[model samples]
Target: MSAAAGAEAWGLAGLASNDPGDIHFDIVLRGYDREQVDERLRFLGDELATAEQALAAARERTAGLEEELASARGELERRVPDPDVGFGNRVEKILRLAEEEAAEIRQRAGTRPRRSSSRPGPRPSSSTPCAMMSSSGCVAPRTCSTSTSTRPGSPTDSRGGSPERRVAWSPRTGED
Candidate 1:
């Protein structure tokens, strides 16, 4: 008898069973088991539909995540500063500040005239032109006047001091 005839006569008791393993097909005279093949096809059809749905959902989620990543990358690019313009501005500001400080230091340092610290010894008179000797120099006046004095050889201050005292310094000698 044919394989189909066997299934019909057997009444296929396990036809409604979920798994193909739950049913058995009878082989007859070197014929293909149509019943077994039909049961396997049914199982595969049901499983394929579920797998296809899950695959579609996964692909959709991946696409959404990729869009979010692209947006984040764009925001990061906007927030970062340009290297050339930003660093150039900072360097220019620093150089300008340094130049101003250098100018102030130059003004504070010079060979301008001031009071002598040692004894009121020989120095240039006020009429003589001042000259640069070393880091510091002074154009002395003929009067023995100083802000504060103690030694007899040095100039005296206004603390019961006498203005009549004079210092004889040579203006043309170029000596202090």
Candidate 2:
């Protein structure tokens, strides 16, 4: 029944009827423990009320945590890049660029004059030797021994100062 209907039907009369002393019992050879039964009922009612309060508090906490979780998910969605749109577009653009570069390289190779021998040329005296990875073709090392810095982008002189000349080289394939 609705709260309004129940309130109209039953007032505070039920509260007065729960008196332990007024409870009726049939007389038998052995009588029931009325006092213990009354005490247990009171204890159980108190425990049920406490449990109901605890349930309400727990429900409120769960609602707050759920709201927090939703907001966190929203923030994460805003910050992180969409893999379908951004990543795929970037990959497609990179592939297109790489294809165009390959086409240009092939065109240049077709027009360029071929060398008679596949053997490596004589190494220059002033240049130092540096090894490349085994999977790729050999590279002619054009590093300067007098230079203080061997690292790329930063050219240095013998005294560990900035150098005027920059050493540069291209890798030649071992194949004909």
Candidate 3:
């Protein structure tokens, strides 16, 4: 007998014992194939295994990238100069010069001749200029000055107060 006929015969035999409803037997026999179901289940299991392997490979790749990034950062830390020693020195000298000039200005404020202006009230020329010089005798156009009178608390703090003071001794490839 054909597969469908065999299933129908089995269903009819079962119904004889239990007196199950005809609709129930029909529903049970329809669209039921044990072998085909088993094959589909195996296919799904194989797909799950493949997906797990891919997930594992992706995790490994992510870990490798993290390690590489850590190594690169370490290398960068080693190569970069300490800003506290290099740029910090230049900034400190500029600040000292500014303070001295401000003090001199305050002292001479009483006696020195002032520029006469037609505009009413004290029209203060707010432009303050400071010069910065490098070790190689190159003078920077702009200078650094702090309005506060207090000196830097620490050598590290002198360099913008950053804990990681990575200053390049010489200009980098792309930097001006």
Candidate 4:
């Protein structure tokens, strides 16, 4: 019939003519020698033992490295200074800057005169009627009252007006 059928028929005829039990026993004895099987088993056992020893050695090395790292970190902590102990140095720096500013202010105040003397006459006293003239010749009438509502460190004659009215002092100008 077909090629597969023909091969299957031949295989069945060969199985019917031969004793299957005898063929299987002969194949098993030829494929497996007792001494060779024992030797292979012993070799596998030796390889497993070698692998276990290597694993143990690796674990011991890892543990030793961890202990050494901890010891080194402990020594470093003892050698380095603590940050909390440096607070006094920071306070000293702030106080030094404050003292320098105060000394500079005192020196400037001592060197400069209190009032400028370039005006035409004596400064207008409080309770006098004064008229302020603008740069464009526009005059505005202002009352000079002796009021205590004066700005601190201002040169106003108790009238909320200063002699240098046109001057605007700013720290960015850097002028004395």
State which candidate has the highest TM-score. Answer: 1
Clash counts per candidate, in order, are 0, 0, 0, 0
Full ranking by TM-score: 1, 4, 3, 2
TM-scores, each model vs. reference: 0.41, 0.35, 0.36, 0.37
Runs in model 2 lying further than 4 Å from the true structure? 1-31, 88-176
What shift in Å separates residue 10 of candidate 4 from its native position after superposition?
39
lDDT (Cα) of model 1: 0.54
Across 7-64, the per-residue lDDT of candidate 2 in tens digits comes to 2354422222346665444445678545434444554476578789999999999999
| Model 4 Cα lDDT, one tens digit per residue, 1-176 | 43223324544222221243522111354685454344434444665777899999999999999999999999999999888767877677556655764587569759987655343324444454433333454234544343232333345444444443122222222231
State residue 144's C-alpha deviation in candidate 4, in Å.
Answer: 29
Tell me how many residue pairs clash in candidate 1. 0
RMSD, candidate 2, Å: 16.6
The models' CA-based lDDT, in order, is 0.54, 0.50, 0.49, 0.50
The residue-by-residue lDDT of candidate 3 on 1-176, one tens digit each, is 43334434545333222232431322236675554444434444665777899999999999999999999999999999898888888788878766775687568666876443332322322324443434555354433221212124422344332222111222223232
Candidate 2 at 130: error in angstroms?
Answer: 22
Residue pairs in collision within model 4: none
lDDT, candidate 2, at 166: 36
Give the better candidate number (1 or 4) by lDDT. 1
